[model samples]
Target chain A: DQQVKQNSPSLSVQEGRISILNCDYTNSMFDYFLWYKKYPAEGPTFLISISSIKDKNEDGRFTVFLNKSAKHLSLHIVPSQPGDSAVYFCAARAEGDSSYKLIFGSGTRLLVRP
Target chain B: NAGVTQTPKFRILKIGQSMTLQCTQDMNHNYMYWYRQDPGMGLKLIYYSVGAGITDKGEVPNGYNVSRSTTEDFPLRLELAAPSQTSVYFCASGAVSEQYFGPGTRLTVT
Candidate 1:
C-alpha cells in the first residue's frame, strides 16, 4: 500500500515566483513530516519539517504547512531560484512509540525556468 | 562528518555474477537502511538494521542479502545478479528524526 503519495510528477515555475509542492498521506498515525531536495548525482538533503502539533513551520524562504485533519502537507518556496530546480521528496514518519519508520513519496521534479 | 559513505559509485555485473555494495557511516548512528531507486520510481526499501547484529527486511528484499557486523558498516550482497536488479542503490543512517543518505551506487547487470 502507498501510505504517502505525490500525484504530480513534475512542476515548472518561473524564477522569482512561488513554487508549491503538495503531498498526501493515508496513514493517520503519522506525526512527523519532512521535505527533502535532491540534485543530480547527489544525495537528498533535508529542507524542512513539521510536527503534527503545529500547522505551519517556516525557515527563511522555505515553509511547510501541515494540515493534520486533512492528512496533507505542502512545501512552498518564495522567489524560487533556478538553483532550486531538483527533485523534491516528501516523507512521513509514524512513530509507534519509539519506533518511527519513514515512508516516502514518489517525488516531484521541479524546474525553475528563468 | 561524512554522514554516510558508499563505495564504488558505479558498477556493472553480468547475469549470474555476484557482488557486494559497501556502505559506511561516521555519525555513529544506530539505524541504517538500504533502498533502491528505479528510473522514474521512488526508492523502495530493501533492508534495514537497527543496530549491529540486528537486521530486518523491507519492502523489496528478494535477490538481496545484508549483514551488519559492526555499527560503522552495513553491506548488501547480491547472490546471483539479474538484469532485473539493475538500478541505483542508496544507503542511509540516522539516530532519530532525520536520515542522511550516501551519494548512491548505480549498478547495471548485463
Candidate 2:
C-alpha cells in the first residue's frame, strides 16, 4: 500500500509563474515531511522540510504548506525558473524512528517553460 | 568531499549471480540506508544501519542483505539474484534531518 501519493504524474508551468505540486498521505503517524528535487541522472537533493508542529515552512523561492487535518501537503515555487524543471518528490517520516526511513511519493515531473 | 559514493554505477547480472553493491560515505555519519527505485515507482527501503555492526531490515528487505563494518562503509549483498531484483539502488547517509544521496546504481538482471 502506498501511504504517500502524488496524484499528478507531471506538471507544466510558465517561467516567472508559480508552480505548485501536491501530495497526500494516509498515515497520521508521520510527523516530518520533506521535499526533494531530482534532476535526470542525479540523486534527489533535499529542498525543504517541515515538522508537524508547523503548518508552513519557507526557503527562498520555495515554500511548503501542510494541512494535518486533511493529511495533505503542497510545495510551491514562486517565479519558477527554467532551472527548476525536474522531478519533485515528497517524503514523510514517522517520529521515534532513529533510522529515519522516509516513505516517498511516486514523484511529479515539473517542467518550467521558458 | 565525496559525501556519498556508490561504485559500479551500472551493472548487468544474470540469474543466479551474486554481487555486492559498494557504498561509502565521508561524512562519518552513524546512519546509513539502502533503497531501490523501480521505474515510475517511489523508492523503497531495503535495509539500514544505525552504527557499526548493527543492521536492520526496512520496508523491503526480502531479497537483500547488508553489513556495516565501519563508520564509512555499508555494503549491500544480493545472494542468488533474480530478475525481479533488478532496479536502481541508492545509498544515503545523514545524522538528523538532511540525508545525502549517492548517484544511483542501475542493475539489470537478465
Candidate 3:
C-alpha cells in the first residue's frame, strides 16, 4: 500500500511563475514531512521540511504548506527557474517510531520552461 | 569530502548470483540507510543502521542483508538474487533528518 501519493506524474510551468506540486498521505500517524529534489542520475537532495506542529515552512524561493485535517501538503516555488526542473519527492515519518524510516512518494517531475 | 561513496555504479547478475554493494561515508554520522528505487516507484528502505555493529530491517529486506562493522562503512549483500531485486540502490548517512545520499548503484538480475 502506498501511504504517500503524488497524483501528478509530471508538471510544467513557465519561468518566473509559481509552480505548485501536490502530495497526499493516508496515514495520520505521520508527523514530519520533507521534500527532496532529484536531478537525473543524481541522488535526492533535501529541500525543506516541516513538523506536524507547524502548517507552513519557507526557505528562500521554496515554501511548503501542510493541512493536517486534509492530509494534504503542497510545495510551491516562486518565480520558478529552469534550474529548478527536477523530480520532487515527498516523504513522511511517523512519530514515536523507533526505526526512523521515511515513506516516500512516487515523485512528480517538474519542468520549468524558459 | 566524499560525503557518501558507492562502488560499482552499475552491475548485472544472473539468477542465483550473489554480490555486495559497498557504501562508505566520511561524515562520521551514526545513522546510515540503504534504499532501493524501482521503475516508476518511490524509494523503499531495505535496511538501516543507527551505529556500528547494529542493523535492522526496513520495509523490503527479504533478499538482502547488511553489516555495519565500522562507523564509515555500511555494505548491503544480496543472496540468490532474483529478477525482482533489480533496481537502483542508494546509500545515505545522517543523524535522522537531512540525509546525504550517494550517487546510486544500478543493478540488473536476469
Candidate 4:
C-alpha cells in the first residue's frame, strides 16, 4: 500500500506566480515529513522538512504547511521561477524507527512557464 | 567527498541471470539502504544496513540480497532475475534524518 500519495501527476504555473504542491499520508505514525526536488536524470535533492509538532516551516521563498488532523501537507513557493520547474517528491519518516527510512510518493512534476 | 556512488549506470540481463549492483559511500555514514523505483511508481525499499555485519529486510526484499561488510559498502544481489525485476535502483546513505542518493542504476531483464 502507498502510505504517501501525491495525487497530482503534474502541475503548471506562470512565472512570478504561486506554486502549490500537495501530499497526503495514511500512516499517522509518521512524525517527520520531507520534500525533494529532482531534475531529469539526476538524483533528488533535499528541499525542506517539518516535524509533526510543527504546523509550518519556511525558508526563503519556500514554505511547508502541515495539517496533522487532515493527514495532509503542502509545499508553497511564492513568485515561482523557471528554475523551480522539476519533479517534487513528498516523503515521511515513521516514528520509533531508528533506520531513518523514508516512504516517498510517486512525485509531482511542476512546470513553470516563463 | 564522493558522497554515494553506484556502478554500471545501465545494464540488461536475460531471465535467470544473476548480477550484483555495487554501492559505496565516502561519507562514512553508518546507515545505508537499497531501493528500487518502478516506472511511474515511488521508491520501494529492499534492504537496509545500520552498520557492518548487520542487515535487515525492508518492504520488498524478495529475490534480492544484501551484505554490509564495511561501513562504506552495501551491495545488492539479484538472483534468478525475472522480467518483473526490471526497474531503476538507487543507493542512499544517511548520517541522521537526511539521505543522499546516487545517480541510480537502470536495469532491464528480458
Candidate 5:
C-alpha cells in the first residue's frame, strides 16, 4: 500500500513563473511533512517542511502548505529558477515513532525552462 | 563533517552472489537507515538502526541483512543476489527531524 502518493509524474514551468507540486497521504497519523529536492546522481537535499499544527510554512522562495482535513500538502516556488529543476520528493513522518521513519511519495520531476 | 558516506558507488553482481554495502556517518547520529530506489519509484526502507547493536526491519527487508556493530557503521548484506535486487541504495542518518543522505550506491544484479 502506498501511504503517500504524488499523482503527477512530471511538471514544467517557466523560470519566472510559479511551480507547484502536490502530494497526498492516506495515513492520518502523519504529523510532519517535508520536501526534498534531488539532482541527477546526487543525494536529495532538504527544501521545506510543515507540521500538522500549521497550515503553511515558508522558506525564501519555497512555501509548503498543509491541509490536514484533505490529507494533502503542496510545495510552491515563486519565480522558479533554472536551478529549481529537479526531482521533488514529499515525505511524511508518523506520530509516536521514535525512529522517525518517513513514508515518501513517488516524486515529481520538475522542469524549469530558462 | 562527511555527514554520511557509502562505499562502492557502483557494483555489478551475478545471480546467487553475495555482497555487502557499507555505510558510515561522522555526525555521531544515533539513528541510521538504509533505503532502495527502483526506476520510476520512490525510496523504500530496507532496514534501520536506532543505535549501535540495535536494528529493525522496515517495509521491505526480505533477501537482505544488516548489522550495526558501531555507531558510525551500518552495513547491508545481500545473501543471494537476484535481478530484482537491482536498484540504487541510499544511507541516511539524523538526530530528530531531517536526515542527511549519502550519494548512493548503484547496484546491478545480472
Candidate 6:
C-alpha cells in the first residue's frame, strides 16, 4: 500500500511565483513529515519538515503546512527559482518507530519556468 | 563530514552475476537504511539497521541482503542479478525526523 501519495505527477510555475506541492497520507499513526528535493543522478536532500502537532513550519522561502484532520501536507515555495526545479518527494514516519522507517510518495516533478 | 558515502556510483551487471553496493556514513548515527528508486517511482525501503549487528527488513527486501557490521557501514548485497533489479539505490543515515542521503549507486542488470 502507498501510505503516502502525491497525486500530481508534475507542476510548473513561473519564476518568482508561488509553487505549491501537496501530499497526503493514509496512516494516522505517522507523526513526522518531511520533504526532499532531488536532482537527476543525485540522492534526495532534505528540504523541510513539520511535526504532526504543528499546523505549520517555515524556513525562509520554504514553508510546510500540516493539516492533521485531513492527513494532508503541502510545501510552498515563495518566489520560486529555476534552481528549485527538481523532483520533490514527501515522506512520513510513524510515531515511536525506532527504526526510522519512512513511507515516501511517488514524487512530483516541479519546473520553475523562467 | 562525508555524511553518507556510496561506492561504485554506477554499475552494470549481467544476469546471474552478483555484486555488493557499499554504503558508509561518518556522522556516527546509529540508524541506517537502504532504499531503491525505480523510474517514475519513489524510493522503497529494502532493509535498515538500528545499530551494529541489528538489522531488519523493510517494504521490499527480497533478492537483497544487508549487514551492519559497524555503526558507520551498511552494505547491500545482491546475490543474483536480474533485469527487474535495475534501478538506483540510496543509503541514508540520521534520525527518523531527518535523513542524510548518499549520492546513490546506479545499477543495471542486463
Q: Highest DockQ among the candidates is held by which one?
A: 6
Query: Model 2 captures what fraction of native contacts?
Result: 0.60
Which portions of model 3 miss their true places by more than 4 Å? none
Tens digits of per-residue lDDT, candidate 5, A11-101, equal: 9999999999999999988989999899998877788889999999999999999999999999999989999999999999888963368
Q: If both were scored by TM-score, which would come out higher, candidate 1 or candidate 6? A: 6
| CAPRI-style quality class for the chain A–B interface of candidate 4 | medium
Each prediction's TM-score against the native? 0.94, 0.98, 0.98, 0.97, 0.97, 0.97
- Please provide, for model 1 over A1-114, each residue's C-alpha lDDT reduced to its tens digit, 9 standing for 90 to 100: 889999999999999999999999999889899998989998888889999999999999999999988899999999899999999999888778525367789999999999
How do these models rank on DockQ, best leading? 6, 3, 2, 5, 4, 1
Q: After superposition, how far is residue A65 of candidate 1 from its true place, in Å?
A: 0.8
| lDDT assessment of candidate 5 | 0.92
Q: Score the docking of each candidate (DockQ).
A: 0.59, 0.69, 0.79, 0.63, 0.65, 0.80
Candidate 5 residue runs with Cα over 4 Å from true position = none
Residue-level lDDT for B62 in candidate 2: 92
Residues A1-114, model 4: lDDT tens digits: 899999999999999999999999999999999998988777777899999999999999999999999999999999899999999999998988633678999999999999
lDDT of each: 0.91, 0.93, 0.94, 0.92, 0.92, 0.94
Sort candidate 6 into its docking category. Answer: high
lDDT at residue A97 of model 2 (Cα atoms): 62
Where is model 2 chain B poorest over a 10-residue stretch in terms of lDDT?
Answer: B92-101
- Model 5: how far residue B110 lies from native, Å: 0.8
Query: Whole-model lDDT for model 4 versus the true structure?
Result: 0.92
Tell me the tens digit of each residue's lDDT in model 3 across B1-110. Answer: 78999988999999999999999999999999999999888899999999999999999999999999999999999999999999999999995568889999999999
On a 0 to 1 TM-score scale, where does candidate 1 land against the true structure? 0.94
Tell me the deviation in Å of residue B43 in model 1.
1.5
lDDT score for residue B9 of model 5: 97
DockQ score of the complex predicted as candidate 3:
0.79
Which residue pairs come into collision in candidate 3? Answer: none
**RMSD vs true structure, all candidates:** 1.6, 1.0, 0.8, 1.2, 1.1, 1.2
